[model samples]
Target: MIREVQEKDYEIYMELTKEFYESDAVLHPIPESHRKAAWEEVMRSKDYVQAYILEEKEEPVGYGLVSKTFSQEAGGMVIWVEELYIRSAYRGLGLGKQFFSFVEREFSSMVSRLRLEVEPENQRAKELYEKIGYEILDYVQMVKERNAER
Candidate 1:
């Protein structure tokens, strides 16, 4: 089952998020303070940022975090899926598909598109996403980081 993350899921969230960042999925490791602040933000349940914890028979299995924004090019709102992580042991069990389904069901009414970025080397994820109707967006994505810690 998929449920919005709460304060009680802090440990699970931290564990999975750490694993994700440490894995080959992300570009670099994030600072602990940044992670902690992100958790606090998720707990606040803001309109733009949302987090969800996936469970199996009441046991936490994985987590997903997404951010919302308006996009004129998209003609409406876009939900950018920032992170989706499943325990190594729990993969291949359809949890990834479940998460996608949950996203559409929970936010399709308010979103024009569901977007996410994937590492080019992560063929498995790219294939899964493509199979689920996510097309490759050819635009070059660039980021300008501020001096403040992320």
Candidate 2:
């Protein structure tokens, strides 16, 4: 079952996120300090970022966090999937797809497009997104690391 995440689920969510980042070959593992801050932001920014928990027999087994963004080009709001994780034990059961479908229904009225970023090496996730109709954007994402000491 999928439901809105509550305050009580934070601890479990943190643990699951940590495990997912650490074990998953694609994701970059974020330090616990950074994860804590990000988690706090998700809890506080209910209007912008909303989290949902996937439960099995009343226990949280997975989670998804999505944020709303305005797109002038699309003339409406778009939903950006910031995070999605399912425990290793619970994977391969179509839970991820179900969670995504739930999100699509939940934001059908406000969302013009659903977007998510995946690491280039994460072919499984890419295949899943493609199966769900997400296409790779034509532009490449570029980044530069800033050196504070300089």
Candidate 3:
């Protein structure tokens, strides 16, 4: 089952997120305190950043975070999935497909499009995403860090 994230799920979320960051596939590790603070801030803004907990047999198994914004190109709201992670023990069980299915059905009328980023090297995830009908955009993804010193 997929449900909205709650304060009670914080510990589980943190544990899974730490594993996600530490994965050899994704080695960007945020400090524990920083991650906690960021999670708290996101939780406080329900309308902007939506977080959902994925559960099985009433136990939290993973989480998905999405942030919404108006996009001129889409001519309506667009939601970008910032993070989606399932516990290693629970992987390969079609949970990711279920999560996307839920999100699409829940937000179909409200958003014009859904978008997510995947590491180029993570072929397993990329294949799953493609199977789910997400096409790769032609444009390159570029980012400018706002807090970096000029």
Candidate 4:
């Protein structure tokens, strides 16, 4: 099951996020401060930066973080799945697919698109995403870090 994140989830959320950043899913380690800030932001605004803890048999196994934004190109709201990490042990059990289904059930009526990014080298994730009908956006992605001096 997937549920909205609550204040009580701070510790586990940080733990899983630490593992996620350390794993190949991300390009670099995110400082704990950033993770803390993210949690605080989520807690502060229910309308943005949504976070959910993924559960199976009533136990937390993973988490997903998403945010939404208006997209003229998409014709409406685009739900950007910023992070969806299932613990390595829980991976092959179909939870990822379950999470996608949850997204569809919960937001299909309101959202124009569901989007995410995957590292090109992460073949397993890419395959699963493709099987789920997520097409790779053929565009050059770029970002400018706000804290370049760090």
Candidate 5:
């Protein structure tokens, strides 16, 4: 089951996010302070961020984070899925598909498209994303650090 994340779910969010960042799928560790601050911002900005707790039998199994921005190419708002992590043991149970379906149903009317980034080495995740109708773009994605240190 999927439910909107609540203040009481903070511990689970932190634990799952730690596991995700520590996994081989991630390229490097993001600073703990940055993660905490981002989570706090998500909780505070409901209009800009949408997060949900993925549960099984009413217990936390994973979580997802989504944010929106205007896109001229998309002709309006586009949703970016920043994180979607399911417990290693609970993978391959179609939870990822369910999560995508839930999000699409919730935001399809407001956004022109949904986007996410996945590590090239994580073929399993890539396949799941493709099955859910996401396609690889020909252009490369790049990021430029505006601050020398943060």
Candidate 6:
């Protein structure tokens, strides 16, 4: 079953986030303190940062986080899929697509576009994203780390 995340599910969400990041391509895990702060921000936001939990017999098995962001140039809301993951054992059963479809339907009224980023090395995830109609953004995402000492 899939449902919106509740405050009671915070621990499960944190566990899943940690497990997914540790097992996958995630470069850094959000510190416990930072995670708490970030989740507080999410909960307090007027526009929702919604999370969907997939459960089996009342235990959370997977989750996805979707949020809406308004585009100034486009003048419409964009649905950003911040994270999606299904436990390894539960993959290949179409749950991921179902999760995406749920997000599409839930935000259809507000969203003008759907957006997500996938690591180049994660071919499985890339294939799934493409299969669901997400195209690669042609521009490379460049970042410069600032040093406090500098």
Q: Scored by CA lDDT, what does every candidate get?
A: 0.89, 0.83, 0.83, 0.89, 0.87, 0.79
| lDDT for each residue of candidate 4 in 1-150, tens digit (9 for 90 to 100) | 889889999989999898999999887787888888889999999677889999989888999998888899999998988999999989999988888888878889989999999988899999999999999998899998996432
Kindly give the stretch of ten consecutive residues in candidate 2 with the minimal lDDT sum.
141-150
Once superposed on the true structure, which residue ranges of model 6 sit more than 4 Å away at CA?
46-48, 143-150
Which segments of model 4 are wrong by more than 4 Å? Answer: none
TM-score of 1: 0.95
The residue pairs in collision within model 6 are none
The TM-score values for the models, in the order shown, are 0.95, 0.87, 0.90, 0.94, 0.94, 0.86
Minimal lDDT window, size 10, model 5: 141-150
lDDT of 2 by residue, 1-150 (tens): 999877888888788778767875444566787667667877787778887888888878988889888999878898999888888788888988998899899999888889988888888889999999999998787878552221
lDDT of 3: 0.83
**Candidate 6: lDDT of 42?**
64
Alpha-carbon RMSD of each model:
1.3, 2.8, 2.3, 1.3, 1.3, 2.9
Q: What is candidate 3's lDDT per residue for 1-150, written digit by digit as tens? A: 999878877888788778777885563766777568657867788667877888889988888888888999999999888788988788899889999998899889999999988888999899999999999898897888754432
**lDDT of model number 5:** 0.87
Task: Kindly list the per-residue Cα lDDT of model 6 for residues 59-98, writing each as its tens digit.
Answer: 7889887777888765799888988888888889888888
Model with the higher TM-score, candidate 2 or 6: 2
- How high is the lDDT of residue 100 in model 3? 95
Please give me the total number of clashing residue pairs in predicted model 1: 0
Better of 3 and 5 by lDDT: 5
